[model samples]
Target chain A: MSYIMLSYTDLLLASLLLMINGVLSVIFSLGLLKRLVIAVTRMVVQLLLVGSILSWLFAAPSPFWTLLAAFVMVAFAGYEIVSRQDRPLKGFWSAGLGAGSMTVASMVIVLLALTTQIRPDPWYHPQYMIPILGMILGNTMTGVSLGLNTLTNAVRREAGAIEAGLILGMSRHKAMQGVIRQSLRNGLMPLINAMSVMGLVSLPGMMTGQILAGAAPQEAVKYQILIMFLISGATGFGVIISVLGASLRLSDNRHRLRLDRLASGNGK
Target chain B: MLEIVNLHRPGLSPVSLRIDDGECLALMGPSGSGKSLILRAVADLDPNEGRVRANGDERSQTPAPLWRQKVGFLPAQPGWWGESVGDHIEKSDSVLDLLHKLHLPDESLNWPVSRLSTGETQRLALIRLLAHAPKVLLLDEPTSALDEEARKSVEALLKAQLSNGVSILLTTHDKKQANRLCQRIFHINKGVVTEAFS
Candidate 1:
């Protein structure tokens, strides 16, 4: 089977389908016309730019390029985590915690997968490295962001209860145990749900894309399973690191809840 | 016994005070006068420049959890994290007695925390503190939410604690209540602590 490349004309045909969405917005007075148009435009530009970058990356296949690509993705994810918070930690701590943990978890998992499961030449081959890192980092970033956001908000809301825990003979770690557990659950819940209903509810993105790209169903299933496991590992590691780090940073060794370390109240 | 030497924080004057074994000291101050500040500092819940010694155990040297358990502090509106009263207030043989003493029924232990009245919450917070029986109690208006009769029952509970050699540092705006329970009263205004005449 030959993989037929999508031409610019075929892309234009896809754009026509988006017109149906625009038509509905206009009919219902949903006021989504502007946003829909802008979003679709941005999506097109961004994805095309990414495609161009990947072409360059695949052409050169330098370790330096791969490293730069990974760093850039992680850095953006770090900022996204901070911006998503309702009450983010003050100053550099937010960015540091998110980015630092993401780098640790996503990089480690991707490297392990590359070495042990799919041994590509030079180990940092852009073909495999970029997509795996992208998938892992995307999910891991969400997990870390949700965990940190939920944690800070919960801590702020439960200030009295947490202090009570401290006064009730609980260590700082012990006092934060409940919140940490909840945050971890919040972070990993999506992965859990997705994994449980993987094939029945909806086909996973990688599997669908691989099958669409003419890969055999059996082979595509293998890659999808491997990717899902990689994502799960990355998400768990990422959430734990960020949540634990946030809990520790927001409290002191004295078991006191240092709410002042947080930047103001809720953003909304 | 508890001793605080020159405890100072932002917007608070340096405070030095002592409570003997089985003694009660009252800190009298209006709202925002740093009454809770002093209690928090003594409890090591906040960063402050001070030396707090409880039963010859220096606060800085002891583990924070141990120190807090030793020097228990309750805020004006104690926080309840659990869903039910029993979750916040531990069950014990003495706890049942304390509940009856505070005029709360045994069923209150099963009551949802959200169902508790302000007065009940305050009383239950007291019971929560008493559950561990800290060596020192830094209470911030422990009876502020209670009515006259309820207040009387809480006072009885404190008196029993005192006789058991538990020292207390109570903050209150009610002079009559302070006079009734505290052996010494210190008035605080604008961060200043001066002996108040009974």
Candidate 2:
């Protein structure tokens, strides 16, 4: 049995349900009413744009278009991570390093999964590769942002501790070992927690999406597990790369912390 | 010998002084007089417009990490990281005997850094500093937290290090300790320096 498709009227009715939430926010004076409305509007607009692009790409099924869409997604993911940092690196280094690391890590993981495990017909099949790459990149971006945030803020706060280590003959990398380790752990915590709570507490988004689209439960479960493994691995790798790259940028060859290279305020 | 040529920071004047081998020079000053700032500058931990040299070797001639290792600066309130006291001390075997000299037991190495008292942490930090056998020791109130007995032991250990041809630059608020341990004393007030005696 295939999933029922939502028509324009059905979507309109579903959107009306959001009015109840808006009314409640207004009645309770939550101060989030405006933000809620703007956010919902943005969600609809952005999803429509992406949906339109995906429809066109799916119909054509060209390797070029598939790669282009993937690149765009990764670019936006990188930008999101950079904009989320509190003490982000200065100028292009902030966006460049973050995007570079995530792109390298996620692309490598997704390609490895596609070429080795999935092995779909034509090898660059849009249907298989796009969603897989999207899931991996989306999750990896969050992890990288967490790692970057933790590293920068922790280094600033623990400057004394790190300086102490540097004064003791440690190389710059060696001096930052403690903070880097903490940051990486923090970056991976969400993925680890999700893995722990899978199926027990709540069904994951990917699994639910698959089930709603009319895939068999067992098949959906299998795909969900595979994607989870991909995401976990990608996030772990991406976070490490981002943290190391960012930390290197923060220090100099003489093992001194050059905090001036970082901008003052956190990014929004 | 240690030489400071026109060392200037925000609050510190262009202070210049020389500390000969096996000599201990004390820096006495009121609070916020940039005493520790001078020490940090000399150690290459802060940005300053000046020069520092040890035994005719300028700090700029060497890398910052190497310079810092050679010219160790112990802050007033020591900064400790890692799980245990032992983790900070490199080449533990060579420095194992020095622990007893500072009244620290062998098992103290296994104790968590969180478990250490302020005095103990200071002493351990001193030992950690000595592990590198820096040619010049820039100490910022190393014994400020110690009691009379612990202070005596630390002073004795420092004096021994001095006797072995190490140059020392130390800061203290206590005039007695300065007179007792320092061969020369320089008083700093409002970022200006005046030599009391040599």
Candidate 3:
């Protein structure tokens, strides 16, 4: 069976289904109509731009272009992490800690996988590199940002306890070990919950997309399993690095809690 | 003995003072006059510009953890991180003795920290710091929340610590308590230190 293609008319018909959401907003006075329009418009514009870029990459693949794309993706991921934080760190740390860890984890994990598991003709082929890197960076960004958010908030909340421990001769690492562990948990919780209900409750996104594009169900499932494991590894690595790095930034060489480094207010 | 020379932190003026071995120096100031910041700076808890010496040895010579071990600063509300009060307080023989002296029962250690009254929290905070056997004690309003009887026990406990050669820097609003307990009272206003010879 051949896969069906959507024309402009078909796309417009599908958008009609979304009208129910606007109706509900109006009936309930939820004030979501404005946001709903903004979100949908933004998604269409962004996805179309990405699609055009992907087509161009496929037409002419090169290592430099691939690297540039990867860098841009990670940069945006870092910016998003900073934006999502309720209380971002002061100065360069607002972007440095999360983005640095995410770039390291996603790049290393993707390189390792492309070379060993899913080797295309040229390992850096845009066909393979772009999609894989995009997936890995997206998931890792969520994990890292969530981890950093939790880490910053916890460090602020536990400033007193940390000082108590420090005054008792405990090192900064020892004082913050508990907060780091909890932060890692918060970062990885979404991935864990998704994996726990993978096939039954929710089909993995990559697998659903692959199956729709006419890949065999078995092939899609196999790739889905691999993708799931890869996402988990990347997310786990990113979360640990980001959380530990953020914790270190919250304290100083004197083992004292540097609460001034944090932006004011209890985080959302 | 702890000597702080030209101790300066942000929002506080320069402070220089000395407390000899077994001496209790009372720090009296209005609210928000940086009394707590002075205590914190002396403890090396905040980044500051100053020279703090314990027993004539520079504090910066030692590692931060070890430095903190020798000089303890108890905040107005001591932060308790553990579920039970005992988790933060090591129950050594001296710790038990201090708790008893502060009128906190041995059973109170097992109680969750949320169960402690303000006076109990203050007393327990002192006991926790005393467990370190610090050479210099920076107490921020150590008896502010206590009643007359409890305040007397706390003062008695501090006297015992002082006799054992512990140098104390105390902040209090109680003038009579300062006159009674402190050898010299130093009033801090706008971070300027003036010796009040009573």
Best by DockQ: 1
Model 1: residues with Cα > 4 Å off, grouped in runs: A265-268, B194-198
In angstroms, the error of model 1 at A42 is: 1.5
lDDT of 1 by residue, B1-198 (tens): 999898898888998988999999999878988898888888888888988899999988999999888888888888876798888777888999999999888888999988889999899888898888899999999988899999999999999889999999999989998888989999998888965665
Q: Local error of candidate 2 at B41, Å? A: 3.4
Ranking by lDDT: 1, 3, 2
Cα lDDT tens digits for candidate 3, B119-188: 9999988888888889999999999999999999999999998999999999999999988778999888
Each model's chain A TM-score: 0.96, 0.94, 0.95
lDDT of 2 by residue, A13-60 (tens): 899999989999989998888999999999999999988988888787
Give each model's clash number: 0, 1, 0
- Clash-forming residue pairs, model 2: A86-A266
| Model 3 lDDT, residue A91, Cα | 83
Docking class of 2: medium
Judging by lDDT against the true structure, name the best candidate: 1
Q: What is the TM-score of each candidate against the true structure?
A: 0.96, 0.83, 0.96
Computed on C-alpha atoms, the DockQ of candidate 1 is 0.79
